[model samples]
Target: MQHSYRQLADLLSKEIRAGRYQVGERLPSVRSYAETHHFSVSTVIRCYRYMESQGLVEARNKSGMFVADWKIQNASADKTTQGKKQPAPPSVEYDKLISLQHRMTELYSLTAQPLHLGLHLASAAPQWYPCEALSKIAQRQLRQQPWQIGDYPTGTGLPALKTGLISWLATCGIDLEPADLLITNGSTEALNVALRAVAQPGDAIIVESPVYFGLLQMIENLGLKAIEIPCVPGAGISLEALEYALEHQTSVRAVVAMPNFQNPLGCAMPEKNKKRLLRLVEQYDLALIEDDVFGDLSHQQERPLAIKAWDKSGRVIYCGSCSKSLAPAFRIGWIAGGRYQSRINSLKLSSSLITPLFEQAVLAEYMQSGALPSHLRKLRERLVANIPLAIAAIQRYFPAGTQVVSPAGGWWLWLELPEHIDSLALLRQAVGKGIAFTPGTLFSSSSKFSHFLRMNIGRPWGREMEQGIKTLGKLAAELHV
Candidate 1:
């Protein structure tokens, strides 16, 4: 638990990084700061001294402390802001992607230990879930709305869920009406609906390179092609590359994006790109399907503004979900489908009929209450805590020339192995040793990411988990050799 002194120092450190205190600017004296914050002078001194130790500030013999000339280590936004001329969209080999489906179909019948794709989520520990509070809220919802369970559900969803979503999203700077949103079974189904509403057979859908496998599967199943746009780890998908695709690819129906805590890559698009994406949608007279299920799981409580927040012409289809942050079993997800709301609503009704009313009502109540923030705080704390341990393990055990990206948020780490090593082969060896990681080939429609792997670091730092990672590293090293 953070004590008063640590909290004070943390807040000050944030302000400094945000440019509230410029480099070399003198900090207020311990007595003045203590009086202003209603803290003891000793507490204030401790806070300053801690900041000094962290290299956020410095002190001289006769002078007061000053803001240190430090480069903040977690500037994920700044890393990928540069423009690049993207290469032409490459031919994708869907062989590995098809094999993944075959394995899943045979998953249950397999005699040996099933390869855990690690997608079922082990990052948010049981201690973090507000089970008791949620149980009470769920019980109360059932008590209050006994009739809702049996009633023919509304075409969209429970009004209360949409209202709660609107309120929650406002905290992230997006506005939506109930009519603007359609609740689906989960973000996966929401993506299905969005894809159905936006694209037809043989249409091209632009997606980030090394995209989410689920989206790739849906695109292939729907007989749609994906135009892969390259994404840099810290920055995001190249805006220039997207512009090139929009200009050249006339058959492209919609662009799918995950601006916040993107899957596999685990990066956020800078705010400038978010706005630029909106402009691109307008310029091409095309549409965007945004997947932001992981938006709420950012390391910081203050989320970056979503791409949909900039849409004015009803061209952006914004998808959100409670699966990653809240209870996954609840299966609550929704889409704000701009101009495509009617089609998406029709697809949702035809696809799943209606989301569970009890789940919707309970989630609505839980989010409106104070419990949501507290649950998110604990979840992010655990997720942020696990990232470094996994990174350190990879660096320590993995072969030379291995690279790992420090994600700005979320639980997965993307590792770029030596070029000679095939991640899919590594996956085969890893499963034998009881370690399961998603191969990079699964993330893309093409074989471009054959040398990459996405490791699930959602599980806490423990001997078993660390050893599993070490074993994974050992397996990869053997493959490299």
Candidate 2:
């Protein structure tokens, strides 16, 4: 029923998503793709252009077509299984995760906490914050209203903060009103509130493979089971696989995702795919929890739109925060609960009561002072600039066949180390050498990612950072079996 060019585009898209092509690798020329597939060059060109518009592939001025970094690497194992439908992932293993957590705790307790360097943490360094400006604002607020700190905060949030967030959300393409928003302690609390609002204990929630560890922890604590769908290199959750899951798994109650600048992976879901995702969720009547904490840290000039931007029926529960982009200690986060506002408010009232009023006031004033845009411009520039330096180090120092993912907009860099090396063992050795990074084993419910790891690229790049990475490389080499 599809047109020939559309059919060809779909076929090539599957190949790219299957790990047949690597990120930053050049695609076959239009002439060659046409000759091999027995299609006209013009048709192939049209297909390529369409894919470009979808953020799948990009055309260089004279260098030919290439896959965008945002759509970078597929799961390495997918290379051999191209065109085959991935089977339903096994139910999330609670015991395995608990053991992994224990091991992480032991590693941390054994290391000298202050002396150990954090290649493990994803937070920006203190120097990166606009401390001088925030200090001035805080002092002025105290001088103007000395009695403000004594008051109990509203259950939902301070009205002024909600109003400011309305304008802020507009920039991200999500139009919201004060009534539609609820402030929380941080994105962590926001996610917890959203999940609790939609799902009950013993329910099944679909999540991405190699998902953020915090979400996995939330699922476990809530006594919910998880079904992970493999993610495509540049695109987000495989809509095909998701639909298949929804068809067979009637117990699935909700799905969680980070569409823009996904954690660990750093890929953005294409706009078309986001729309399709909304439609699919609507078809099956499921709720979608969208985590957009890192959406503001794009390497490019334009910010990508959130999945909630396309939600028409209110099936999407949108969550975001200032924690990653600015003022981490302020603990400012919010949700545009769409259709779930009432239940979310109830949950907010039940847990944590409300976010701090004084902090919210400070954040609101700072957001409105025309200072945030300038700060983010500089922050984004610094974060993006660090990627190449980190990648160069990885390629030069790490053992060959050690694959690293160059994220498009986020601060995290994910690495797929050689199969023989265990990240936990490497972390132990690296910790002994005064460095620490998150082992990939912590990110999933299974042991499949034990050979992987994630590094924070948000920190300022310098000799100390480079040496730490080089040392990690040396340690990885030593651990190879």
Candidate 3:
């Protein structure tokens, strides 16, 4: 077979396996595919016809070629014959099944617009990112492997990067061996892998009320039920409420939490509460998924200890990422699965092979050179300066009754608006004024946080941001009427 046709066929097969070309799913149009690939239209038509002859696809008039149902049946049979089980039949439409994708799209679209006070900002301004450092590392990598352009990182991820993580964690009082760590795309993938390793569908899980919206979406995506516990703003999750949920909800399989600089709220659990939560985990025989993505972005230089430090029984699954300190595009994160290391590693293999190797290698180099710590120090200083500016802006512009929590660390400030003013409606109005903030309704399944909004204070507090807050406050005042 010619290389062109073979390459196209391979691409089609990979999509089919990945379920993007699901059974009976329509393939891209010949003209579109040809234009995308920069190939002649005849070549594209030939590929489709070849697929049809092999019974891998079918054509429909006025529509397009679709993946043949027999292709899936054949694949299923091949799996069975090879002693591999086929995936379960999907219970919902693929688009409907992944709720986070939709929410993320909405968030991204909002940011893509030319906005002044986009409160959904997750990291620092792009100018603050270490792009030059990353570029240098990437260039060096290409120079060394001039001919090797295609290489997939195995599920284990880059060895040097994993070692770097182990060394870095040790500095924070987390003494995990390299074998205990599994690198993932980000903390999001780490959470998904940990959840799959420990829990099943319909299993009850303990989550903080007004928890991380992304985590809530993940829980819903996995078909798990969340038993929400009331959590204090300054003080992490309510230990008493957590204990009650654990004691009463025997079906609870895991407790997902962010012990330090938690998302949206920026609350760090006290040292005493961290110890108590670990004890409860052991007593209830549950898994603890600790998301610490924002841990390194603390305003204070004195790093608070991670929950994993108190995990003697190996039930804690500690997850962290450099998305805040470094950059979100890096997508390099890891999970330290105390005792369930191998299971999480296996799950990583089954999901995506691994993160991009070149990026990991560059990150490892950056960490070894102490660039990471230096960058983090600067980031912390900037955040510490920005936080007060944000609070002052809020106080000056927000309604008189509006309440705000001054977090000891992290870059987010949670606002408690008046009960009658819906945050979702406020968000719509804010966006119209070129402002964006996370509506509290996205934080929980119950939608009980209708009057709250999570503001990102990571960006510099300038005239644009200050003006945006004033506009948001004006909108809030209108809603009050």
Candidate 4:
């Protein structure tokens, strides 16, 4: 059962997530809202308060409720369909992954190579980083508070950073108290800490098929087994597939998912699917460890509400970081452990102690300066232009059946090479030609997606980018024959 405030929050959240309310829009007044909802004045006020708490709306002293720019939109397709249980992917066992571990080593080594035009790395170009902005912030912080750096930071990050994060996260519809957030090195550490808190070694956790290789590495490092549920290109994990897994796999303790701009697949789950995911997790009593590192990178003006924003039961451990959108060097990421805050905090203390306060303060100061939104707006304009250009290049140079996924957010373009082409082998040949790409095998523990590969598109398209893409397309074409 949900509280009345929570219910109203859901309806309003859905509308906001669906982009019914634009950035800087205004919501209905309490009097009108109360009459329309058939609720009393107090109930309406409570609902508004709840909405404000989530960062969805805010109250101006004299004015009524106004929307915040937190939930901006990116490039999500409106198309949605009822999800059917997909055919299960090849199962992964511990021994098999260990044997195939060499692939991980090889993939990482490739990234280290000095490819002048590296298309394999998903990190934003150095030019894209807000180095200048952060440098200014760092300098100001040093001047004002020289003694601040001497203190050993709290295990739960700096107080100001967490406080700023709450208001920032609300834009994405994830409102929380500062205490709920535990900061770590990056989203990786946040994900690592959250997983360790919820599940132990040898426990099985469900991950999306063709998942983020970084998460796959985390699972392997933790000595856990990764189970696969197919994430369709446009649709995310199907309810039927999740239900099947829940019913069949009793040992499955937690399911780690990225609902927004999901890695490798370049897909964002729809609002309806997000609600369904919550229901399934609740019904099965499973932990939903949500990775939302890419939610803010949407190409649209409206931001999608993270699934955590709709979590009423406190089961979603929402992880976020600036590695994707802001400066990666900041190493600032956090997890709002709804019901598992204490457990997450305990794990944080034992593992990393806490991220340095100086870096956290730098980020906090930058956010307060209002530079993040301005930076994202400029970056997104480049992506909107770059995606179509890259897609055009792929179409021009690749074989007939080769396909690419142009997601509304994130920094990569997922390519499904024509059947029978060995992307890994092609990558090997391409590497020597001064080109790079992320092979699909790296994203999976099983044999699936062998004909698939992902290309990094974090920079603007130009001669070098086009030439590198054409060269890779030529290699893919040669292999297809």
Best by lDDT: 2
State the RMSD for candidate 2: 19.2
Per-candidate local distance difference test: 0.78, 0.82, 0.78, 0.80
Residue-wise C-alpha lDDT for candidate 3, range 1-481, written one tens digit per residue: 5668667877887777788878888878766777888876556655776766666777553256778776565787777867533332111111122244454554566568888666787777876778888888779878997543586556477888888888888877898766888888988899999988898999988888778877877888898887888888677899998987777787899999888887778888899999999998998889999988888877677788998987888999999997877867888889998878889988888778767777788888887888888888888898899887888888898887899888878888899998867776677567777889887767766546768899887776678878878888898888775
Off by over 4 Å in 1: 1-123, 140-149
Question: Which residue window of length 10 is worst by lDDT in model 3?
Answer: 88-97
TM for every model, in the order presented, reads 0.76, 0.79, 0.77, 0.78
Tell me the lDDT of candidate 3.
0.78
Instruction: Summarize candidate 1's per-residue lDDT along 1-481 as a digit string, tens digits.
Output: 8899999998898899899999989888766787898997657766876776666777543255778666742243246535322221111121232344543332222224665434224245555667777789888867887786678775678888888888888888788877888888889999999999988999999999878887887888898988899997688888888888788888999989999988888898899888888888888888899999888889977878888888888899989888778877787888999999999888888878888788888888887786788788888889898888888999999999999988988888899999867776676566666567777777776667888888777655788877888888898888766
> Residue by residue across 101-173, what tens digits does model 2's lDDT show?
5545544664546544687776888778887888899999999998898877766888988888888788878
| lDDT, candidate 4, 153-191, per-residue tens | 665778878878998999988878878888888999989
Is candidate 1 or 3 superior in lDDT?
Answer: 3
Which portions of model 4 show Cα errors greater than 4 Å? Answer: 1-100
- Which residue pairs clash in candidate 1? 123-458
Q: For residue 248, what is the lDDT in candidate 4? A: 90
Over all chains combined, what TM-score does candidate 3 have?
0.77
